[model samples]
Target: MVTKTSADVVIVGTGVVGVVIAEQMLDAGHSVLMIEAGPRVSRAEVVENWRNSPLGVKGDTSVAYPSRPWAPHPMGGEKPEDAYLQFSGPDAYDQTFIRYAGGSTWHWAGTSWRLTPEDMRINSLYGVGRDWAFDYETLEPYYVRTEHKLGICGPADRTQQWPQTGTRSAPYPMPALPFSPGEVKFTEVVKTLGYNNIPVAQARNSGMPYDGRPACCGNNNCVPVCPVAAKYDAETALHRLEKKGATLLVDSVVYKVETSAQNKIEAVHFYDQHKQSHRISGKLFVLACNGLENPKLLLMSTDDRNPNGIANSSDQVGRNMMDHPARSFTVTTKEPFWSGIGPVVNSGIMETSQGSFRSEHAGAYFRYNNFARNRFVTFAALKKGLVGKALDEEIRRMTACTADIVAAHEILADPNNRLTLSDKKDWLGLPKPSIHYDVGDYVRKCWEVYSQPIGKQIAEAMGATDIKISPKFNNSKHIMGGTIMGKDASNSVVDVDCRAHDHENLFIPGGGAMAAGACGNSTITMVALALKAGDAMVDQMRGA
Candidate 1:
């Protein structure tokens, strides 16, 4: 049987962005309803799933939250899987995003970074990429709010932070987590090369408990699932919103958005697990369905008045797809520096992410990956035909001596690298997303000119004996720029507030609204934009 519902606000995709918006709306005493395409599972279930996973799927984060047939997510195995995203370009867009109740935050490393004032004005300063519609100053307060909401722990000293400009409005909720022996060693070695390795601001707890979650014990399983809930995830906010009177519907996939003759979003139609249809009407509609899925939904909602899709008046709904494409290398060091302690990633080199070099090529942020290498090293040891104590000794040696470093480069906004509805369909008969991706000459030049040299230098600084650099670029999973924001509507899908220019009551928040994909992880910026959009939506609802 079909059903119908009404609310003051309707949000699709119960990810961190959607939950943040819902929390704000609920706090403002507005009736909120959220739709999630995937099923809801508990933290214990996810942790157990990871624990029981096969050897090949153990480290693969997406396997922790199994995808439903109706809602498919990209998965990576020994060989990269392209079952969900159809790649059509030189480079593959093998993005891993869980469609579960809490969305992709289930697998994030919890790094919360704020873009510098200069990062928002790349076009004006660096002569490449489109500038954000507004400056960082306008977004600073919201960044603070997001940090406080997520209970981020970072260094109080501004010098230990990126940018080092003292742009913070408030101190971090907790003090920074102490670095591991490997991080200390890496930092010491890099300093000899005049490189600064600063602590990354993370959403996980440090010392004291916060927001009903315990302090992080540094289990080193930040990815796949944070078992103790020490790290912030969308599920925390979702539960908070639910307690504040927000209605959440799981296994409900929003398929079409309906707009009135006045160009105001009146209702959205969704299909449940059983393929039963339902209509949800609201005064305001927000699509927090990530970069790729958000644009796909908008393009799918074609009507008589909107033949080119609901928000495709400018033909830019699914254009300008971007991400922080990474190139990584592994090096065997001289001495043992055990890396399996603390978080998966705790610190990075942010100095190279800025400079005049960005005008010609992209800038990059480098990191010493701290993921436990037991699984990786064991596989290598077995492949070497070692047995018994020899294999054990080799595993221990490889685990402690091998250092994996990754350099993630910023990519300029190129409309040619896009996400379009594919001719193929999914289990529910909806068109799958097909991506045409090219890392562009800007990023390629960055790898050749800046990233490779710096990476080799860092390896040498650590006294590496054997080094192997990846031949091709890889996706960082920080998807951005499908429904990009701009002041103008001609070439953009949304305005500064993430409001669709074609529909007054429609808002698309999250990474899809990002104008430029910076070098660092973009989750914090996405949440900030969502908070800003929440404020806008509140103003509209209050008639202010």
Candidate 2:
């Protein structure tokens, strides 16, 4: 028999957005019960597994990810595996996510960028895309709060957008991390060209410790698992909240959000690890599931009351489906390289984010970062033939010579790029989400115009020879909207406060509700919006 527990709120995910919301709600005097399909990940286990395993991959889970409990889900400092999610046909690349606590942040690159102002209002400014029901001003405060929570480090880039993103706020919990040799060289060239080469806006504390987390040791194994908890994972916040008396149910997948005939939420029914069923009811229902999973649950819970989906009377639960299309290339040059800072502090340009440039379609500035291949093993992994310090020096020279540049992501506004319920279902017979997305023409243009010039400049500065193309593309991990926000309910999912227009007690937060897709690495914005959503829910609770 399965055990049942109850709280004022039952959060369906333990990812960053859900975790943060839970923490905020608990702090606000709300009893929250978070349901996560993955079990609690022990940091020590992750370190030991990575250290003992081949290729530094975590060996805990056999399904796909080694460190992560879920596949196609990404997190910070981890590399994404193309083999994780396999899709066939012309409409494949649409479905991608890590179904675990902290979600895909386990394998994320640790870059925490806030969305530009234009991202909030693509429809109002241009005749393209859809207008956000709420504007950037509403989200700016929450963004500041999230920055404080995650220990972000970066100088304010006023020229980019939203100059007042808290230039006067408390200093970053930690000082900025150092730039690698390749990035420093690129910085010089960019300065010579009269452009602002910005340091990465990261979630890890490097120069000093903040919020009780340890400073990054530049383990270089930022992906897979960090023996040291340098990167911010949602688990940290979730565990803290749980300690504060919030409840978290592990290995439980919420099957459907069962509601009453009066259009009021009755309870959420889920399957426990033992495959037993239980229901947990609350005054309000918050679906903190990701962009894909949120819609899937709603659609599955259809009844005579809601034939389409719960809170999806507008049939806008799984539409829009926006994600950044990144174009990355590697260039190498002979600049003397030294440093263990290969993890997240690599620097690059941000000159294009602001000011108007007319193209056939909407376009904005891009971001650049230094990336290089990691080769060689720890000193302990050295074979009998190569044990000397001199041998180590030679290995570093080859692997550290190359640099990576990740540029502006083009946002394609197509209703066709969206999520849909698959006739196929999971082990529990719940409809699994399938995404259908095709890169837009604007994405192609941004790639062609920027790649060669940026690569040639960086390679020349780094003194690298034979710059080449790396086939790895952005796997569409920044799952934005199927549930978008707009002026009209006919075209969007939620309203200004993220309240489902059809249901008063239901709310959806994070990138899943984003009206517009942003530049690469948009976690900060998600965190902010989640906080905003939590506040809105709290207000509603008080009104009741």
Which has the greatest lDDT?
1
Which tens-of-lDDT digit does each residue in 1-544 have in candidate 1?
Answer: 1123988889999999999999999888889989999999999999998999887668688778888877887766523333878888899987889888888898899998788888889999999999999998899999889989988889999888765653777888889999999999999999999999999999999998999999999899999889998999998777778778888899888889988888788899988989888999988899997788898999999987789998888898888999999988899987987987999889999888988888999999999899888876778888999889998899999999997999999998888888899988887889889899999999999999889999999999898999999889989999999899998899899998999989989999889989996898999999999999999999999998
Q: Which candidate is the best by TM-score?
A: 1
Candidate 1 lDDT for residue 362: 91
For candidate 2, write residues 1-544 as lDDT tens digits: 1124677777888888888878877887888888876666677765665566655433222223342322223323332232333233344453345566666566566676666566566656655566567766667777678878887776544443233333333444455577666556666766675666666667887767767777887776655455577777776666588687788787777888877878877789888766788888887677877877787778788988889988777778876777776555555557644433556444545445433432334343344443234532333234535657866765676556555555556475577776677665455655546666766765555556654465456556556675665453465367787777665777677877777777777788878778776554667777887888888888887884
- RMSD (CA, Å), candidate 1 to true, equals 1.9
TM-score of 2: 0.86
Q: What is the C-alpha local distance difference test score of candidate 1?
A: 0.89
